[model samples]
Target chain A: MSDPSSLLGALRVVLVGTSHPGNIGGVARAMKNMGLKDLRLVAPRAQFPHPEAEFRASGATDILNDVVVNDTLEEALADRTLVAGTSARSRHLPWPLLNPRELAGRLQDELRQPEHRIALVFGREDRGLSNEELQLCHLHVHIPTNPEFSSLNLAAAVQVLSYEVRMALVEQAETASRKEDQPFGTEWDAPLATSESLERFFEHLEKTLVDIEFHDPNNPRKSLSRLRRLYLRARPDSNEINMLRGILTSTQKAAGTKK
Target chain B: MSDPSSLLGALRVVLVGTSHPGNIGGVARAMKNMGLKDLRLVAPRAQFPHPEAEFRASGATDILNDVVVNDTLEEALADRTLVAGTSARSRHLPWPLLNPRELAGRLQDELRQPEHRIALVFGREDRGLSNEELQLCHLHVHIPTNPEFSSLNLAAAVQVLSYEVRMALVEQAETASRKEDQPFGTEWDAPLATSESLERFFEHLEKTLVDIEFHDPNNPRKSLSRLRRLYLRARPDSNEINMLRGILTSTQKAAGTKK
Candidate 1:
């Protein structure tokens, strides 16, 4: 499933109640560093046109100058298909905490689908996103930092998440393009076996083990199913499968020689 | 040969003709974040008691309050050895442009030897280190960024360079501890392969490749050399070496069957 729109430009970064204009400038700079350009500021406390912002922006003043200012949070996220709010701590709300890596993985999968315009919503400096604001987002992303001191600056939070997203997008694109070049019929061409495939492999493996007297056939309840599942969950590759089969063949040959 | 007399506290960061006192405050904050306590300012345009700077300093007001005001660049670097200037662009001067990573590598090597206190000199935001100012340093450290747009803030530059120093210190300490734990004669107990063992494996591998007609005995120049370097760079563990030897033996048997 090839996406028609590019992932880079489709990402809308919305910063709500940004106290310092310089952090807004820093966020824009960090976003541009990771190839994201669309920036929106909602209900900012400081004047963004201040000379301090432009000076701190370095080369990313364009992102600041062209930023869309909104009065309300709803107006900022009206156009977005999916919204993810950044949170450092888990709230009492039932919203599950998706760490940066997990969020990136989910985003990578979502990007493959069409018309997926995602918005990364960040809260103010002093207090993070309110519970009502958290409810607006479909997912909550938490960056895994030192547990004792997880106080990440607003721009630093954006930097880490945006960096992970950019890396994941590039990696996924490279792998997809490589897969496209290879023929689709051969075993190698088949999608690499995931955990689901390994589960099916275990069922077949267990039956074979019982047939070969490797497990106790007399007591059906004394099955080696746990061992089967453990090996299958490891998700051994094709080369590993060939190596294991070779060992099994050699063992059988040695047993025949003894007989 | 560690030198005990090296002036650890002599390394001074001097900011000259700074337009904003808040940036001076930010520089102080950045310096403290990297375990640097000493800060010197030379002719700041903004007043020292600016409320914006104190507010922006967060808890780092100590750095701003105790800042030493200098009259000139000569006064700043008067008592320092091995002054290094930072710039993003390469000047025609014979001074090599070492990036943050390269500078850290050089500092790691230099810190091992006895030398005067190293001074990391930074310039104002408007115009970076002038030609004459740059000439004062033994070397120039450059942060590799976009060539078309390479303007980094004065405080940001200090933060990045200081972070590099902190990382280098931690890495040097870790290396020293590892060396103490595993001395020369205890090479067998070390997790990775020793140089002698790796050399033996490479010799056997090269001979096997020649025997299997994978490498040309005559006119062998580039390919084998590259392969050897690749393996040497990999620094394979004992288990990996054993696996490679097993594969080589299997390949030899397969070749014999074909013959």
Candidate 2:
């Protein structure tokens, strides 16, 4: 079996528009405590390398030392295979949602492919992830906090999710060690498409829909978003996505010839 | 079955000889986040009414307001029937130990008797529970953290343990309710699409695909089957199916008029 640390290493935490330096430091500590190494920040409102963050990091200063700061969420998630955005209980959009534990379970399943990089994106402290930001993610994760006082401290939310991921990894390692010495069989015939590929496909899909006059740009009733959600939930493999793009190209060509 | 909140309310978190007042406040917030109400302190070094603690507690100041203080661990355990001391791995004494999840399971089992009181004791930031303090407990609970960086921030530790307890209680309540409730959800605003509607939608989808030159009538390549599988897996509601059919009709009309 492959080393579980590699899997753990592949998972990164992305904080977007964080207002507090202390929370970023606390998140570093929490991630280190659970053996998560990668930390990325997008458009943080707080100053990096601030004294408060350093004080809060305690011994986990190493994580803060190598933190990657990005200008946008899309740039932070450009390389990730799967992305899950943290959301509060209620949102206007109906998206594919999973609880923290379920998110861990899904990650564990995805981590079977060691190259499958994943990102858990946390948005602003007060606003949580915006609808536009959340739409970029394949799945939405909601921590089952007390509904009445549902807003969890950002660092605390990271702590809970990191703890769940650690538990899943530890459990997987234990189960692997307990079993006979044999490699796990690959579950999927084809690797899943990356986020970048999926984005391109979605763009092509929107353009083709407009080309065929099926989707009206002037009066869109979130039809594109609904279709995006549908495809994202499907999680098409690389081959399937290629075929889909091919079909879109053919549809565009056919409509152009008729016109 | 007793109320889950009552069980959670009966479980008290005890901080022994804590040096950080912020941790105390943070603990209160974590406890409140998980629906646990009771908090106790034993010989805390930080000032009880410290502003840092109050600031750290966020909106959970109510838990801090109702906090109980004791002079010694014995006083804190006076009324509790079961006690679990949080410890790091590889202590001097080989005592009866359980992971945080196992401790939560034990608590869930003991909670069958509503009168059973429980205490989870956390020690100082620098040093864990003293040998004598740990001796007073029936079980030692260790959080499974990375050995390289073993010390979890005091509030983060509270968050993990409280999260586990909350999960256990929520699961128990869910299992009990699931047996009594109907199999499927009665909460959906729109009823499911009928088989006839789905079949008609599929037929329309096939025709639209052919018109768009996306599907070959002469040289079939299982593309239609794949599309069928995608739609079937989505399980679109009646309104969604109608919307999809409308899109297909629009696509066909656009293609026909262009031709």
Candidate 3:
């Protein structure tokens, strides 16, 4: 039901520990290019209204003028339901990583919820997102730049991401209006089954299967992980999850001496 | 069997009469980000090896070092099968116009031919493509900018196009590999029917129709133009074009006419 501009309005660009004033201005310029209005600066190295920052902002002075500065990362992302951090290198932990395009698709799904806001967090130009900062994010976004020369300027990185978000939102709006290839309307759209709900379902299913002597919990193999992948791939809806749980409940009851 | 790298190798970025050294550096950085290795600068204002340009180029020093500077636009676009001029504003003449995404699709089609090279020409930052320079291109590329504030930086424009081309090439490579959704392999893939063949087919179709009294040339009520739209939309492969031409010929012969 929401327009692209509304979706864009709900999206915020948060920069952490920005060193250069020109890049701050560049980020503002880039955000405005994609009709994104909100810019949250977290502990910037440079002061606002610097000459270089103003010079680089070009005509996007409004975005620069209206920026919200925060002293901490938590404050910058306080109201966001979904947070994605930008990182160029691999991390030790295999956090759920998504490329820019996949992140856009996830945004499209999340933005359907009323008043839901998303934050795209960009790290320092030199060292990238701190482990603590990155772990706060639900997903990590990688831009997929050339491996040999992937040191993208902070502003250029912002430009690339904002452009993609704009493209994705615009394309979604066009598809919604045209209704071509898009099956049904928002009326038929099923509520997305949350990760918590999915996890709960998995736990319940595992317990019920063990009660029915179908699964041996003592020496469980890769079945749990494999089934996790299968179900996640299915992206089951809330209704589908409820039906599945009902089936499991019946299976548990069918077992001898099981309530 | 061209890889994305090969496609990028065949593609060239030609900047015409660029005035800013920083923008030039930024362009190189943007090009490298999208795996575009070739850059041709036509009569730049700033001197080569400028410190500011180098500084702005960040880690993409290789792209900056290997740039080919030409005295004329012709040299920059030499042997390019498709030349697209980037213009921010609308011009008087109705040149063949395409947005960035469509331009990528055209590139995908054209690059299939042997030794095919394409030039994406970026004009001066302030003035954009001059009438003379724009005329040199076969198509005009207009990035859809926010009307309220459409003054995109020159390097930003380059970044947008380069990003789009990279995405398009990557998507094509992924599609080719999927092999599931695609109906047949590239060997079964038909060569796109050339304009010459389509034009010839149209001529034959028209002449045969006129002789058989199926079409009246005297008072054509936009029939031919409409049919042109139809066939063009279909984008028939060589085999389909020949089959269609055969049907027209048989129809003409069935009407007892020998041309």
Candidate 1 Cα outliers beyond 4 Å, as residue runs: A1-16, A29-36, A40-59, A68-123, A127-259, B1-11, B108-116, B170-259
Report the number of backbone clashes for model 1: 0
Q: Which candidate is the best by lDDT?
A: 2
DockQ of each: 0.06, 0.47, 0.10
User: Which tens-of-lDDT digit does each residue in B37-118 have in candidate 3?
Assistant: 8898999877776887887888778989899889999888878888999986578988888878888888876765666778
Query: Candidate 1's residue-wise lDDT over B1-259, tens digit each?
Result: 2221122233467787788877776666666555565688777777886887776565567777778888887787887777788875757767877766567667755654456566788887778878988888888987643333455556666766665565465556655666553321123222556687777777766665555444333445544554454465444555445544544454444435222
What is the Cα-based lDDT of residue B221 in candidate 1?
A: 53
Ranking 2 against 3 by TM-score, winner: 2
User: Can you give the lDDT of residue A160 in candidate 3?
Assistant: 77
Which tens-of-lDDT digit does each residue in A1-259 have in candidate 2?
Answer: 4445556777899999999999999999999888888999999999997999999988899999989999989889888878999987566557777777778877776665665779999989889888888988988888776655677889999999988987887777767654221112235556667888889998998887777677534447577777776677767778678777877776777667333
> How should the candidates be ordered by DockQ, best one leading?
2, 3, 1
lDDT of 3 at B87: 80
lDDT of each: 0.60, 0.81, 0.71
Candidate order (lDDT): 2, 3, 1
Which residue pairs in candidate 2 have backbone atoms (N, alpha carbon, C) closer than 3 angstroms, thus clashing? none
Give the higher-lDDT candidate: 1 or 2: 2
Error of 3 at B65 (Å): 2.3
Give lDDT: candidate 2, residue B19.
Answer: 94
> Which CAPRI tier for candidate 3?
incorrect
